[model samples]
Target chain A: MISVTALTVSRGERLLFRDLSFHVASGEAVALTGANGAGKTSLLRTLAGFIRPDAGTVTFSAADPAEARAGHLHWLGHLDGLKTGRRAREELAFQARWAGADADGIAAAVDVLALEPLLDLEVRKLSAGQRRRLAFARVIAAPRPLWLLDEPFAPLDARWRAALGLMMQAHLDKGGAILAAVHDPLPVAARALDIGAGR
Target chain B: MILFRRELALAWSGGGGPLLACGFFLCLTVLIPLAAGGDPAGLRPIAGGVAWLALALSSILSLERLFERDLEDGALDLIALGPAPLELVVLAKAKAQWLAVGVPLALTAPVAAITLGLPPAQAPLVLLSALVGSLGFALTGALGAALALGSKRGGLLIAVVVLPLFIPPVVFGAGALERATNGLDPAPALAFLAAWVLFAAVVTPFAGAAAIRNAQG
Candidate 1:
């Protein structure tokens, strides 16, 4: 679904990764593993078109870069990206409209994440696990083909982690692709790529 | 459509932006009198000018957040990933901000002008100029904010970048008010002010979008 060739990413004076290449196909999940500061997030950002690469190209085999960018991927970065002052429901609705998701998508995401009771509260008041779950819901909110996740399961407890695993399995079953940076084991069977080793 | 509503809600929320700008506008009107002593003649002459300056300065306060906040929260990335052109997103945000902050500030101008001893007859022109000038301010200010997007000193940088751009509007607006108050023809100055707004409106979206796209790295 997504491919990169001869990708090199650097942060200021330090080089994070060099001459990297990888691909994730439909119905596949790639677990990007690396130690801290090993360019895991950088790779995800680069593929998601957030960071410009120092070298090489990231392309979709079936579509143009712009189409791949517009609605093909859902990125869950380090920050939850929720507005602290806005209510949870309001934030989700805003994102839904922007992401071109419909009412059913929003409701399914809210239900899967079990966010019904938390809808009225401001985002700032939500706990860490809840916050992470709220962000995770975006993947479900819009059924995008690609997901660029940075530490996808970091803040959730075991149960929520399991729920996330189930969601990933379901998404993969539906022919979606995932590129996630993980520090721990993911319940879904994934092809692991260690960024540090590639470096 | 959704982006506009969300921007408006965020701007007007508690401790958000628009109300704070109005408060700042009121403070400037109140303080100038105390600073200048109780000389009605001197105060009346400069009232329009002081209001123009305050409006320009207060406009800076909100512009800093126009893009910076979204950039920080990762929302900018999401917006960029959307189907809409980034230029339209930049323009929509500035328009929403103007509706939230500029409209309220413009509406409050006549009252603020009255408090600053601007002749009651000049209040209408003061209000008109404020409305037009704010459109210029909002557009130019968005460009400045986009330019200073990732800077550590974003607020100061935006002020420095935007304040200079504000001068033309301030000059034209104040000229319109002064001429009208003096019972002279203010038509030429008003025309210039209107032209400046249209110019800012056209230039900002393209320039601001490029600045924002460059900063994403």
Candidate 2:
């Protein structure tokens, strides 16, 4: 579980949000709803420890800030993080191992994502939805308590989008926490947090 | 270990690998005699200096991408989230750079030195100094690369930041070869080169990690 108190973040001379406070408890998904230029991604990054907040505190109940960042969460940002030169299998294996997943975990992820046929191709050769699926596969391969997703379903087609919704439901069922930044409705049930609305 | 292996593979297969640096190094060495006139006697005195200069420049060739690629592709974010501390990740990357880029250039340095009229008797010292000096280059180069991440003209920024850091190793490595060429004791200079490498190894990981974290924000 994560909590933010009086979180204020600014970029350059512009203030994105101020005095924002929210928390996502276990088995919950908090969809961040706001217009572009709002502090949704910034909030996620702040919690993930990528951005230092101008003012406020983000705390994880189970672990210290550093430990929570290092091993407790999955961050799926806009970029897929796959190396263009690497084979899909190579990328998946490396990411899975890097996340401390066992071989069985990787096998299960491959099965769920239907990644077997695309394993040998270079990442650049994969289609957009395929690449997005590959990106989401790492999250499945490694079980983390929290996922800080920025537009989790952006590039996927309808079928994959629905599939990911089901996956999110399963994750919530297992007591994981999610803080996602999105423009559209999340496939599963989620409490909406409107950033910058007070301002 | 997986991170190290992945870095090494990326260094080798992507962005022309060690081949590009080696080619740039060889070309620089070859151009020296042509530009200065083909007089072995004239070139011999500065051969060590020229080779060291070429080595320094070649080391800079691949540094621009060391951290830039990861940052641009978002791998850096995930890397920071991994179980290893960010400092360890920086250390692994620098170590992999030494193995991938530094070692190949070190192996090719003796040949370049000898071709530039360095005495074959001093070839072994040239090889040893280059081996150690390139380690310094790789370590400091990673720091420079990390510092220049997300900048508009990152390659230029990396060169500006890294070339100054190269001065110590270049001085020590070239000084070692010069001493040997003059039939003096080269041990002290070689020791200096090793010390520079140790200093770089000590300072780069923490500094580079900080730079990386700053870039993330």
Candidate 3:
């Protein structure tokens, strides 16, 4: 579903990676592992089109660039991007509508993530793990063809992490692809791409 | 459509934005007379100018929060990847803010003029000219907020960036009221103020979106 060639990413005067290449096909998952400050997040961001590469092209073979960016991919970053003043349910529903999800999709995501109990609580009042769970639910709420997760497992307990692994496996079972930046191993089988090796 | 409503709800979530801007205008109007030694005759000639200046300054109060909060909280990244063009997103945010904050300042301009000792006969012109003028200020202020998105001192930077852009509208809006009070034709000045707003409405979105992209990078 995605491909890149000779990708070079730099931060200011420092070079993070050079001459990098990788691909993720449907029903596949690519685990990105590297040392701290090894540009895993930067690479995910580059693929998500948030940062322009120093040199290379990111091609989504089946769709135009704009369409691929608009609804085809789902991104989970560190901040969760949630409003503290709103309830968990309100936040999830807004994201669902924004991503073109219907009622059943939202319901299934809530059920899978076990978020029904915390839906009425405002984001500010939720614990860190609960917030992380809610953020992941946003992705499940509107299942995109491609998922770009930057450090998706942080702040979760063992059970939630295992649940996330199961969720990722189910997504792959449904022919979805995932590219995740992580320090720990992913739950499903994935081809590991170590960014620090070539440097 | 969801984003627009979301912006409006966010703006009013804390409380009513218009109520505070209106209160700010009232306090500013009352201050001008005291600053001028409480002479009614002395305050009349510059009442329109004082009212326009207050409106311009008050509009800046809410602008620094426009894109800064979203940028800090990671919302900008998801918003950038959304289906709508970034320019439309920027426009929706600015328009929602104007409805929440700018309209009340304009609605209360005539009261400020009255507090500053302007004759009641010219109240309608004061209100109309200020209405169009504040929209111009809101558009420019949105652009300025985007430009200063991640700066260390974004609030001060916004004030510096937008105050210069506000000069033409302030001159035209204050001039329209000045002409009406002097019993001269106010059409040309009011027309100029409206023209400035129309121009700003067209150009601000592109510039604001570009600034947002730059800040995100």
Candidate 4:
């Protein structure tokens, strides 16, 4: 659904990547493999429209890139974006609503993530893995066409990693696309795009 | 609506939001009498000006973390991807700050004026000017906070960027109180203050949204 053509991104004086071109069609998952500081996250941020590329263009199939970034994609970055002072339920509800998800969608996400028992506790009290699951719940609650994940399974336990793999499979089966930045192999099969090799 | 509610709740729950500003304002009012020698005649004439100054400074107190917290915690990224335009999101944040902290500071302005020797009869003018002036502060403060995002010394950077923007509102607010103290019409100055606030309200969203986008990049 999205294509990048000769994309070049730089951070201050250093160039992260240059002349990089790739595409992800519907019902596909592409794993972005790279060494540290190899521009995987930068590429994701650029696609999500947070960072403007130094050169070249990234064009989407149907919607304008900006609109697509705003409405059609889910970006799960390193940070959970949960406020420590807020209850877990409040965070989830706010995120779900902010993403335009209905109450039924939130309930289904909660069920899939097994978030019921942890709903009442404050976010600060939850462990990192729980917080990560809570963060992932936002994606499930809101059905976006594209998923831009940065090390999506980094904080999850083995069981959750497997569960999240199933979710990704289901998402791809339903005509969704995924571009995940990762060091290890993804649980589900994906085309490996080696950013480090692109250098 | 959800964003506004979330910001309001966050402001009240942690970091002593409104209370901190009011306490600083009261402290400034109390210190003026102590520093300027406790004579009513001397303090009375300058009470409104001093109160306005304190209000402006107090408004700066809670602003350092306005957008910085969101940026640091990665909420800004999610916010960027939300359905609302970035300009509206910035406006919502400033509105939330106004409701959460500015309103309480406005409420405390009159008390601070009276403490600084302003006549109780003129307290309503102090309250009115402060209400409008604080809104201006919140808007300009959001711009400042957004601009100062990702900087090393964010708090100081916000004050440096915001205090200059605070000048016009301070002048208008203080002038309104000064006119009332002299028994002339205070409406003109209050109108000017409101107009300035409206201008800030209009400009801050666009400018602050740009700053937020830059910071995110």
lDDT of 1 at A61: 67
DockQ of 1: 0.64
Native-to-model Cα distance after best TM-score fit, residue A135 in candidate 4, in Å: 0.2
Candidate 3 lDDT at A158 equals: 94
- For each candidate, report its DockQ versus the true two-chain complex: 0.64, 0.88, 0.72, 0.82
lDDT of candidate 1 over A117-137, digit per residue (tens): 999999999998998887777
Model 3 interface root-mean-square deviation: 1.1
Off by over 4 Å in 1: B14-16
Name the runs in model 2 displaced over 4 angstroms.
none
Relative to the real complex, the DockQ score for model 2 comes to 0.88
Candidate 3 residue A150 Cα shift, in angstroms, is 0.8
TM-score of chain B of each: 0.96, 0.98, 0.96, 0.98
Which 10-residue window in model 3 chain B sums to the lowest lDDT? B12-21
Q: Write the per-residue lDDT of candidate 2 for residues B10-67, one digit (tens) a residue.
A: 9999977699999999999889899998888899898999999999999998888889
Tens-place lDDT per residue, model 3, A1-199, is 9998898988888788898987899999999999999999889888888878899888897698778988899989887888899899988887776776789999998999999999999999999899999888878988788999998989999999999999999889998999999899898999999999845
lDDT score, candidate 3: 0.88
Off by over 4 Å in 4: none
TM-score of chain A of each: 0.97, 0.98, 0.97, 0.98
RMSD of each: 1.6, 0.9, 1.4, 0.8
Return the DockQ of model 3: 0.72
